[model samples]
Target chain A: MVNMLSIKNLHAGIEEKNILKGLDLTINPGEVHAIMGPNGAGKSTLGYVLSGRDGYEVTEGEATLNGQDLLDMEIEERAVAGLFLAFQYPVEIPGVSNMVFMKESVNAARIARGQEEYTAGEFLKLAKEACKQVQLPLDFLKRGVNEGFSGGEKKRNEIMQMILLQPSICFLDETDSGLDVDALKTVADGVNSQRSPERSFVVVTHYQRLLDYIKPDFVHILADGKIIKSGDASLALKIENEGYGFLGLNYVEEKA
Target chain B: MSQWLEDVIAHAEQPASNELAATWLAEQRNSSLKKLKEQKWPTRRTEAWANTSLVSVESRNAKPTPANITSWDKPAIPGLDSIDIYFVGGQLKTDLSTFTLPEGLSIYTLQDEKAEAVAASRFAQIKPERHIFGLINDAIANSGVVIDVAENAIIDTPIRLIHLANDGVENHSRVLVNVAKHAKVTIIEHGVGEEDSVNTSMSEFDVADNATLYHYRFALFTQKALHVGGCHFQVGASSYINSTIVAFGSDLSKLNIDVNYTGEHSNVDINAMYLLAEGEAFDLQSTIEHAVPNGTSNEKVHGIIGDRARANFGGRIHIHRDAQKTLAQLNNRNLLLSRRALINTKPELEIYADDVRCAHGATIAEIDDESLYYLLTRGIPRSQALIMLNFGFIQELINDIEIDPIRAWLTDMLSTRFKSMEVS
Candidate 1:
């Protein structure tokens, strides 16, 4: 079976320091992969580098989605090629409405894919349905994008975008960080609803609590810019039970 | 002295063909002529005109536009149903006999006998004396309008004053308005021109005690047209004035606005926007004075400079010693879309009252890369995302407009203008 995402020896950094040094990962179709790490483990850096964010330099490595060379495309081109990054701290665009923004993004992706663009009525229908699934009020569609949204609401908004765009592979960059128990379950349920044979997910988090709801098929421990260990769901249970000290490493909580 | 000044003086010295000026107007013109003679032409040393040039107004050939040429098209605001008054080439085109006057509302030409008292009271009264173009306008502007609203009257329909400039003509236009006590009215000053011409359009308003005035001024000119104008207002006790000013830069366009709060408990709010493209230039200066206690004034100015265009904004708020408990604020923000585009912004606050609250800020910025990246990650193309972001910046001010049709008209008009601008 073909891999949905493949990253080999990914050595990327921002400004002079290398954060993702010699990292490798593979994600198969329909599989859920949870990345667990302590502070400064390059988890978020991996997501940013894969999404082609500016200032993130891939010094030595190859990353591809399906058969396309993701590194060769522009940021929006990479997005059009079915790569999505759910920002940990979503940006607030005070004047651009959420509904209008999603419609533009959806039609932009569709135009690049040589597919038919969604009409206003059709897009409105889909947007309303997505808002319902996230349990957000429909009036949020008319409000500014992420403007004045609370932490949980921002995370849910990211999922709403995911539902509307329907990208092939998604990287949730600490999306569960600020969410409460109820919000985490709502977010996990949104992700679970989109799981299919043609879709894959990379969930990055600092805590093991979120793993209980999402139930990742595979778990990996990343430390010091590389993956140090890989196992099944039980590995997450072990880390939760015994912290990072069993691996002979100091467990420093990330500073805000 | 510049040759343009010499020629303008010569033109002002020549008597009008039918010189039957009223006693008050004649005295005002003579004083204005004396001031013009003593004032030196503005050079780079002039603080108020430091970043603007008068070459476009200087080099134009002077030609008097023919009388009553009403062939020009008038822009209509859909669903507004305003009472339109047209002035083409500094001449009134609307015939007074064509429509009946709404009750308690009166419109008259400056030369009409019925407008004598208003013209005498407000001809050159409120505008500052330092403006050379305004002085020239006072000396020779024979075409103007006077509008009066009676006490305790509420005018439903807006009064529109449309001025159109013709090629090679030196058009000097003027307007004076009086809103009586407890009355309410809306006025729109619409100016549009596209020619190798120069125009100075000045207007003044007196909002009386407990009255309300909603005002808008649109300066729509580009290419070879040149415009220098002023809008002045005097707020009475407990009165309110809400004004919006929009401009599209011409070869050289300069506008000055002055608002004075003469009575206590009066309030004034102003929002001004300028959009410049290509080699166009726009210079805007506004001053709000809180002269009495418990008066408040707020001014917000924003601009977009694209291509090789240039924009300048100067905002001043003054709280006098007697104006205790005054609240005044001024904010100016600009966006430069190209490396060659230029913006100069200066916001000033002068307060002599110890109990007053006054603050001013100015900022010039480029497109934010983080916001751009955020949009790109959502699959929107770079160009489309830019238009969205740029328009979003100005939409904040547009949303403040209370009139639905005018707001919608401006949204459509400005979006087209914004799209045509070159952003690097």
Candidate 2:
């Protein structure tokens, strides 16, 4: 059987310097993987490449989903192709309403899938239901998208879109970084409700605390542009207790 | 098109009448016509005409036929069917009109002999040096609808003037409005024509003491046409005048809206929107002369230019030396969808008085790419996403409209136009 997502010998960089060198990973549909690494290990660069962001050129290798090429699609096309990236720093757009943007986006996705667009009532119902699960107020949707929103609110709103789109492969990149305890729990609870046997997620972070709530089925240590170790949930606590220093030899050499 | 254009051009200068008018008025008009003949018709070479040069009427190579018929009846906008007079193609179409106006509200055509005082103060008082069309109007104007709202009489119903012309034709029409002291009224003038017609005309409005008026115009015509119109307003003391213009018709058009805020504590609000596509052009020239103290004025114009079309806005605010504590603002913004599209804007504020609040700003740019990507990531198609963002740019000013029908009609038409122009 084919792996749901495969990244093999993936090397990428930001201007003149290589960030992800000879990275390799593969995951099936029923897996939740956590990628923990030290500073400057290309964790964010990997996220940027996967999301089709500009300026992060993929130098070599394939990052594919379901045997289809991912790098060649437009950013929006990549989004419509069952992919989601919860930004580390969400973008704010004034004057564009949150509700109108979401409805238009949902309809766009539906139209691409050869389905009918949602009416005003149908969109309201879907958006309301999503807001309930995420614990966000409906009125927040009426204001401009992310204008003047708190840091925590911006992250929650990103997850709100994730829930609304229901992408098969969701990448929550540093979602819990700026969030407080309550916002984190609400966001985590929202994510937990979205898990399914046919869906998979890659949660990228520097710390392992988020794994306490997400409970990744697999933990992979990514350091120096490559995965050096793999283990179960306990590997996260091992990094939490030992600070990624005692994860073994490759990590020590990486530090040096 | 020229044949149809000549028919209208012939109407541009009303035949000089032989009737014995009071000497002062007749000489006023004669001298004004002489002034029209003295100066050449403004061309693309003049400062005011640099961006919106007036193309000659003879370019059509044919005379107007006076019979450019149409297939579509003007769609029914709320409160439009109740107008006092209905004119199409410079000819009154009485059968299409239905109304039972209040006691003091009535319409009179210029052909009627009752226009003695009106023909004097309005026609003779017009500034002949600014535009050539007004002079042509003075020389050839045959008739216009005159609405009179008496003092202490509040007209609950709006008076609408609908001007419709045919394809490949030049349409010259005129209208005069009189709002008496202490009276309240609203006037909506819409100029619509086929995509292939040419339209040019001027209108004069007067508001008396303690009177209030809401004046509006919509340029929803064909893209193959050219339209130029002018509006001159003399506002009285302690009165209010609000003007809103939506220019979307014609391939090339220029609109001149000026208000002489001559009254103390008088208020004026002017707002406009233009949507351009292809080789189409939208031009606006405005002047607000503050002749008295304690007057307030607000002006805002928004434009969205697509394809290779161009939009130019020229505005000037003039305050007299004695006019103190005046408040005025002018803002203009443009959205260019194509790299080749252009928007030329100039906002001028000339203050001769002290203790005034006046400011102006102009911007030309493409839609925000970050905003575009953000919306697209949410599943909104590229086209719908653009419409949503574009509407937000003008929503605040659109909300500034108090009359419900004008606002709704503008919104609906703009949405449809936006979708039709959707970038493929």
Candidate 3:
């Protein structure tokens, strides 16, 4: 099977600190990869690097999507290439409406792939349907992007965008942190419905609860900017029960 | 040489320009012209022109020359239909004038003696120590748009004042708009021209009791022109006024938007935008006077500077000693798109009333990188995203532009003016 994403010897960091050092991971299509890590173990940095955040410098190794060189592309080009990342801390844009932002984004990706941009009516139809799937209210589309949303609402909004965008490979960085049970279920369902043999998902989480709901095919444990263990979904249980300290790693700083 | 100034003032014979003024108004214009000759041209030493240059005004000739209108061409201003008026060099282009005055409203150029005298007396309480251009507008304003919005008449359409400059010679012009009690109307002053020749202009606005006005101005000009204009608003009891000024060019431009809430419960909202690029210079000096009790005023201005361009904003909010519950706020923010660009913003609040709420702030900085990258991650091209971010910064206030035609016109001008800026 062709791998949907491949990261090898990835050494990335912001400023002087190397947050993601010598990290190697491979994600195949149809697989849900759950990355569980200690607080500063490069989990979020990895997500940012994959999405091409400006400040994070990628020093070593290479990351590729399908067979294309992903690390070398610009941020927007990478997004057009089917990379979608749900940020851990979403920024609030004061004046651009969510609907306008969504439509522009959808058409931008479509145009990059030689597809015609969606008409206003078509864009609204798709946006409305996605909002329903994520259980977001209709009025959410009228307000500025993430301007006045609550924490859970913001998370649901991100998932709603993911549904509308429908990228080939999606990255959810701590998307479940602020969600309530109902919101979490809606988000999980939104993700599950998009699962297909040709699509892949990378879910970076802080708790084992999201894993129970997400049902990942593989689980990876990361510490000290590197992934130390990888196994089937059961690996999440060992880490959840043993608390990561048993791996000869001082995860006390992470737990604190 | 046929005297250009004589030809400019002899615009009365043009039927198109004199369509609105009454017979008596034409007679009053002669007296006003006599008055204009008595005053000397204003200079930078004056209090109002403190931060501006007076080179254009000092160099302009004041003389008697036989007129010839044959060589002049009709000028064009984008979104011309929005207003009805013949433009000046800042002189009136008599051949291209039109007037479709709404009911209970009348417009007359001071060139008409009878109409000029009637305007002078009827609105005598609203004048502010007439300047040289004001005198010119009064004496020789052979073409001026006079608006007398009837009491309680709600005008749904915006009356546009289109000023087009047609000659390579100096010209001066003026605008006077009066709204009666309980009347509602919006007068848009769209100033767009490229005159290698210089020009000076003024607009005096009056709003009576319980009236409302949305006065918007768009000045996109060339370095050869210098816009030293003034806008005086005399607000009556319980009236509301919103003023928006968008300035893009001028070798030197100074707009003093003065608002006086003369009666109780009057309110004023002033918002302006200035985009200075290349070697152009732009400045907006605003003064808000809360003269009566419970008067409120708010001012917001944004400047976008690039290359060697410069922008200056001096916003002053004053609250009278007896005025209580006066809420005033002034904020000015600028983005320096180039390191060579310079901008100076002064936010001043003078509150003699102890119970007033007056606050002002100014900030200048570059666009945030995180914001740039965030948009990029959403698949917006870097350049496109930068434009979006800039647009987004001003979207909240810009969304208030009610007329579709004007809104579209503003968008078109903004997009076309900035080469690297994209609208789609």
Q: Sort by lDDT, best first.
A: 1, 2, 3
Order of quality (TM-score): 2, 1, 3
Give the alpha carbon lDDT tens digit for every residue of B337-396 in model 1. 999999989898888999988888988888878888889998898878887887776778
lDDT of each: 0.87, 0.75, 0.74
TM-score to native of every candidate shown: 0.83, 0.84, 0.80
Show the colliding residue pairs in model 1. none
lDDT over C-alpha atoms for residue A212 of model 1:
85
Q: What is the TM-score (0 to 1) of candidate 1?
A: 0.83
Give one digit per residue, the lDDT tens place, for model 2 in B119-207.
55675364435776566555444335656788878987787777666655445566777788999888888787655665656777788
The lDDT leader among the candidates is 1
Worst 10 residues of 2 chain A by lDDT: A247-256
* DockQ, candidate no. 1: 0.65
TM-score of chain B of each: 0.96, 0.89, 0.82
Which candidate do you rate higher for lDDT, 1 or 3?
1
- Output the number of the DockQ-best candidate: 1
Docking band of candidate 3? medium
Residue by residue across B191-250, what tens digits does model 3's lDDT show? 655666544556777889999998887776667766656677889999999887888867
Runs of candidate 1 exceeding 4 Å displacement? A1-28, A33-46, A55-74, A77-81, A92-156, A176-186, A204-256, B17-24, B59-70, B381-384, B387-393
By lDDT, the better pick of 1 and 2 is: 1
